[model samples]
Target: MATIFTIPGSLRSGSSNHNILKFLGTLVPDGINYTIYDSLATIPPFDPGLDNDTTPQPVAELHRLITNADAIIICTPEYAFGVPGQLKNALDWLVSSGTLVDKPVALITASSSGEYAHPSLLRTLGALSANVIEEACLLVPFIRARIQDGVLDDELKEQLESAFESLLKAL
Candidate 1:
């Protein structure tokens, strides 16, 4: 089975980005395994000095998850017109590890106006040598309006399924 690691780049409990990721998890096709890495909040701030064989527990765990996954999907919200600090910090920890090198990645920027973080996230993932599938990457603007009562609308669901299909094909 193909294993997909999902990262929701928001710490807020009720974030629309997080909700969308949750929705995507439920739509995984047969023969595919989907897991959401829900430990971003527990990860310590990135520090080059600490990026070594003796990495912190949380960082090591994150590394392990990424290393074992067949593909990755990241759904994030733009913060202050840029990538969120927490998500950026998590990516920073992977820079030297090579865990993401050539890994197939799907990026979804979900927010009111996600243009800024969408490109910024792509640049960062590219720098890490990840093979980001362009067709799978999406900028979902006004995301809050698309979700109601914890469920994504049919149209958004179809978009997510298309992105997920593209990601699987790239894998």
Candidate 2:
């Protein structure tokens, strides 16, 4: 069975970014398993002192989750026109652990205006050597307004489902 690990880049409780993840869970059709990593809050800051030694338990667990997954879906929310520090920290941890290297990844962001962070994040992911599936990316502006009650608008639901299905095919 193919498995996909989805990371919601926003730490906001009940954030639309996370709501999209929940929607994705329901959309995971037969023949594919989608797992949501809901422990982002437990991951500690990246510290070199913990690098090779027994790292923070949560960090190790997160690494294992990504390392075992067939692909990754990252949904971020831009903060100050750039990536959130928490998400960047998580990626930094993955970089040192080599968990994301060569993994097929889809980078997405929820925005109120435009894809302000996508370009920077795309470049950063490229530098990390992740096999990012650019075609699978999406920049959803005014996501909260566009998605109603945890469901995407009629027009966007099909698009999101198709994007996910495409990522599944790649996996």
Clash statistics: count for each candidate? 0, 0
lDDT minimum window of 10 residues, candidate 1: 21-30
TM agreement with the true structure for every prediction:
0.96, 0.92
Supply the TM-score for candidate 1: 0.96
Alpha carbon deviation, residue 154, candidate 2 (Å): 1.5
Best TM-score among the predictions, by candidate number: 1
Off by over 4 Å in 2: none
| Cα displacement (Å) at residue 98, model 2 | 1.3
Strongest candidate by lDDT: 1
> For residues 94-141, what per-residue lDDT tens digits would candidate 1 score against the true structure?
999999999999999999899899999999999999999998999999
